[model samples]
Target chain A: MSGSLLITFDKVWKSYGQGEATVHALAGVDLAIRSGEFVAIMGPSGSGKSTAMNIIGCLDTPTAGTYSFMGIDAGRLDRNRRAMLRNLYVGFVFQGYNLLPRTTAVENVELPLIYRGAAARERHDLAMKALAEVGLVGREHHTPAELSGGQQQRVAIARAIVTRPTLLVADEPTGNLDTARTHEIMELLTRLNTELGLTIAMVTHEADVAAYAERTIRFLDGHVASDAVNLEVAQP
Target chain B: MIWETVRLSLLSVRRNVLRSFLTLLGIVIGVAAVIAMLTIGSGTTEKVKADISKLGSNLLVVRPGRPAGPGGPGGLDQATNPLGSKELAALVAHLSGARAISPASQKQVRVIFGTESLTSGVTGTDSAYLDARDWKLVSGRPFSDSEIRSGTGVCLIGETVRQQFFGAGDPEGEIIRVNRTSCKIVGLLEPKGYTGFGQDQDNVVLMPLAAYQRRIAGNRDIDSIYVAADDRTPTTELLPRVEDILRDARRIPPDREDDFSIRDMTQIADAMASATTTMTGMLGAVAGVSLLVGGIGIMNIMLVSVTERTREIGIRLAIGAHEKHILIQFLVEATVLSLLGGIIGILIGLALAGLASLTLAIPFAPSLAVILLAVGFSALIGMVFGFFPALRGARLDPIDALRHE
Candidate 1:
């Protein structure tokens, strides 16, 4: 079900400091991901995977190359403009779940919609739908501290999808979960990809977590080491 | 959005109750002091005006001696000619705008009736004295012109004298001894209360001018003259005429300052009121210094709050909050805090002023304008002091703030 390209990175470079102390986080990276595709990014430490993911989510801009999102040169935009782009199209699921502590799961899910300036009632209904989609119907009132780790991750995913974004950028979404919880989370994400056609780009060091994606791209020393497709999972 | 921001700010303020109260203390004390000082000052002004008006309205007091100066004794020079019958006679004869002109000589004298005795102010004045001083008698009649001329031993007893010698009983037709001479109380003076300077105006006796001069003061020297202006004649217009007439009667040359000073009660009232106003303003300015210090305290606490909530700010930023949104939230929080302090301070200040008014016997004059100004000022202080810290929080990089532990 792959469609037209939605994200592209051409010779993207991100560096820190200046001159002799410069450290390149992403160097000469070239990548493309199309709509309805679930792509997994894998790398060792300091292999530029996180930096590439950050650029794709518009949380950061490329230091020296072009980053195009849905035909717009997003890397050239200012901080506020990129923030608007992220709010409109990109939803993020971090490894830490990143649900605000002491906040209820529904409230946490309603956060992105709040930034979108949706009316309170509409935001609540949409957040409730998103939570139900993540299988967190009766747990809407439970705070992040009260919820289990997997449930908290589900709440974070609900927050990411509350605005019905086109792209979901998950950075090691199941890194903090155990094996069974991880399987459940990966399965829910797979159902979302197939049913809603939500484009997903995930970063992970775990091999099994990367196995859920339709395509896999590996980074080593700030460059893509390989790009391949999984031939299995056609039945599942 | 603003309502939402205000609600959020109020929630945050409520979360740290003790810290918010501590931050509010400076503003509270400042506003309290300002309110109390202004309220008491206005009350004092009102009391002073009332005291002067009690002396007389549209009236002037002509006293012997040049006006008091820094280099000279304050209106106590005994060498200058005393205002006497001659000046009184000239004013009565030639002054057209004067409604009444009367001369008075006064002394502290011991008066005795039955077994009771009290030391009271005794004054000798003509029948026109009551008209000139705007005084009224509650019972009996003023002295006849024959009594004023013939040095008759008749008098009017004031409220304090009647209370001491008669005890709620009418003092009219009662005989009281003044000094060594006996006099009949022909009238009861109305209760005039006390002057602003705490002098009991009711503890006095009034008698015929000839009787007081002959029996009590033992001299023909008149102490002062009261001149009341008629309606339609402004005191300003009558003042120059009185000066000219007095100058002519005293035979003073055009170049030399007159030996007698004439005081307009209205002018004195204005001066005293304005003096109190100036004092109030100065005290308010001093209290305003504390408000500034309070503002600094707010800034300090807001800075700490920003640091403590850096991660929260980071999350808000990552979720697409604008810099202005973060700034407005903290600003609203500070404003709410200080406004609460200001309101509390106003109530406390009013209480203090009420207590002062009770003890000092002045009017309770709480000005709504002053209260409103204080409220507006505290809000401004919050906005002014809360700005830098709010900006500091707003300008933080989302990544760096998120990374902050």
Candidate 2:
């Protein structure tokens, strides 16, 4: 059964600059992602995939048309209000594994909760649980520099889920990983999507990465080129 | 939440120890200058007040001159008539509210005892000189009234003179030659140490006015008259009376200015103390300018730090950190850094002040209020200078910042 829509974009347009030099990043893009769905966004550079992901995560607002999240017109909200929405509902994992350098893994995971005004003890416990879920229990005290690429990515994932956010926005999460590490990270993400029914919108260029998602959306020339279900992949 | 932010800032500060210390140097020197100047200034003020008090309390000095004006030579005026025994006798007889009236004239003369010879200030006055000056004798007795009237060669030697000629032996009954005349020592004057002007107060000898005029000065001109006010009288109230008595004793005409000047020691004390306070304030203000420069230094470094940590700011923002959070974090970092500099500066400053006090022979006076104000001011400087850079960091666009290398 299809779940209710958690994100919707109705002809969303994001433009840069003004007048003749203007470039449209997202041109009248329309898309919908349901709760509990793992969607992969595929496109070449400047194909509006990253722009759509930013809009979905509430990091940026559309220049025209509506971008709604859960039941709210998020594009119309102010920067601080959008920041609050993002903090409450969205988590981000970046290609660079953007955990703060020189900070312990557990401390990095507690960062989002710090902004949430969580008490120290409660934040520590939640961060510990999140780290354990990411299979980084023994490396909680290791800094990013001390951890390997895969381990650092796992810490980033722990940080992303520490707040138990409703949606996870991952941009090229496995782009820097090797073949084996990529498979391991993909399996961990798939298990999270199935067991927790967490909504995930990941941006990636690889075909195998897209196949791991339940649905794949392709963009070209600032518009959605195609959307299809991955029928060959086994359902959870 | 504040504690977490503070901890984060501390970690950031510690990450670059050398840079942090260099950034703090300006504040340290500024605070140290302020503390040292203020502490030494107050100590000098105390020394000046103490020196003035040592001259005498409730006392006035009548000198034979017009009051000195700016750029003009001070003390005795060459054109005016010198005070003599007539002025002294006039005050002793006509002036009321005066506890004692004594006249003194001084000259530097070589004194010889056996093979040892030293230059000494020889002062001539009456038996009442000790009472008027608030001076005491360590041993023996002051000159008798008969000795003062008859010009006997009896004199009292100060501690410095006794140390030079007697070498810790008893000076009483010992005869010392004063400018070719031999005088017998009757008493040992108590030690008064040195004045703030570095003038030695105990390197002299005291004798009767009659003996000094007859044997040493060979003249009856008195240099100054010492008038001490009674217990119930204020110097301000006693000043005019002495002036009137002196004018009449000299028979100064009503149309002309008086030939003598009477100075109140209490007034001079107040003026000197106020001058010292003004000097201290000026030094402190100059030091305050350095603190401003130090604050600007903080602002410059904080701006550079914000630029360097743009990506970190983006990471925090992406995870939902508010603008105020970023602003407060930088502000706290700057404050903690400046406060640490202030503490170190205080210690160094006090040590410098203590050393100065030891060398200059002034009291070591450290004021609590000044130290507290320095602490508060350094913190305020951090907040004020840190505001602009912090605002810049807080206003950065998350996407743009994240894209920064």
Candidate 3:
């Protein structure tokens, strides 16, 4: 049915605690995404959409069931293994655009390369290439404080792509941007997913942001309410 | 990698230069105090050792005592009071290791030379006294053995006595009088400032033993005897044997306490060395406590730094910049502060030590071990006080940290 699904979540359950204090952040969520697909997870404030994004990003583990990313069995991954998995295949972009403010745009992008112990020249070349891809080529020398909120988010995007990770995990990537900059950010993400054939999964509450993805998955309480292919996707 | 991390941390420090300098103040002062205290303490110990060694490490002092009376006729016995001419002759005859011995008497009296008059101490002994106490004549010569036996009214006056009696003039070979007796000064002794008891040693004159016994002490008995051991003998090995000889000379019965005392200069040296070591240890401890305070100051500022840069930690974490990287950055920053502080403190301490030596008229000597210990200790402080803050920064959650205001 699915051609070697890049990501597969099988009846996964994630809860906050034991007994009476257990917060059912996710309950029996099953999902699958093929290679090169762009999907958006949409939900209300109390829904488990963010939890699903965290699990997909390898920032957390599920209480029950199995998660396989790119045919790798990730359910029993240790801390080192999870870190290695995140480094090798997944890149995260937070809602707040968590770029180290003290670092310039290129240096911010160079951070993941540093973790990979890349040589200085290679790291610089890759970071600049990623920044240029996001259309921040000449602005690589500017720190986050010197950039606009949209520019900062773009730099975060540049950093996430620096290592050429297989999966791009964004949690409200354009939350702090205006409508125009939000469109610019969504356009950048769509181009990366389609043109570069990079698999992308994003979590958002904004209907307009969700419209950019080819598929939309909706959550209610702690379970998926509906999953459907977008009929009128606005992505590149 | 270390240098890169150092450079980054240094840049962070530069971002808030005033805060960084203020945070490092404690380290600087602590290091300086440690160096200063150690240098001065060592200088003091050095001065004491030099002075004590001047007493001639091989010298032994002896004094006569009354012999106990048998059922007490005149309340004295030959066994209690001895060590007279016979004991002296026996020691000089039998002990091959004995270099020389001086019989001595002391008197406090007034000295007059022409129109000059001064009250000073006078000692009566032979040539051996000069060698035993490491005394040398600055001018003229010491009294001959012929002069000592004939009770020749010749004297050797110390620097203070000469200055008092003759002012800037050469007092040696000049005639001076003690009480009512005329004596010519045959030698001028070099200055020996004071003893541990603050007694002025340079204000005395030396005369013949027989002259002092007949003219001043008015008795036949000598006050004390000073013995010098040969170069082939060591004070440590010779002391007990000499003690046994003195006990035998005094004729103390077996299993009995000897009446007279024998003082070896070696004991004085050991006691003084012990005291100085104790003082150095105490001062080092106090300086160590100040260094601890300095370390705490570093920790306090690092804690504030972590709190201030919460969002930075969050960002680094999100980028997969491992917890170890954050830990190393903060640790390196603190270590740099402490190391620089240590350097400055060492210089200041040595300067203080030099100043003390200059003012106190003692020798200034630097100690390398102390300096190295200070540097190492400061480095350790940086690590100990820096760990918790670095760990706190490393453990921050990417989500909460990114959200921190």
- Sliding window of 10 residues with minimal summed lDDT for model 2 chain A: A227-236
Candidate 1, B10-89: lDDT as tens digits = 86777688999899999899889999999999999889888888898889888889987775764647578887788988
Q: What lDDT score belongs to each candidate, Candidate 1 first? A: 0.89, 0.91, 0.81
Error of 1 at A196 (Å): 3.3
Please list the residue runs of candidate 1 whose C-alpha ends up more than 4 Å from where it truly belongs after superposition: A39-44, A95-105, A135-152, A172-191, A204-218, A226-236, B111-118, B138-141, B144-147, B150-188, B251-257, B338-355
Per-residue lDDT value at B274 in model 1: 89
Per-residue alpha-carbon lDDT of model 3 for B221-335, expressed as tens digits? Answer: 6666777788898766666676677667667688876566567777777788789879988987888888899999999999998999998876666666667877888898888
**Candidate maximizing TM-score:** 2
Best by lDDT: 2
Query: What ranking emerges by DockQ with the best candidate at the front?
Result: 2, 1, 3
True contacts kept of each: 0.26, 0.60, 0.32
TM-score for the B chain of model 3: 0.84
For candidate 2, the clash count comes to 0
DockQ of all candidates, in order?
Answer: 0.41, 0.71, 0.32
CAPRI band of model 3?
acceptable
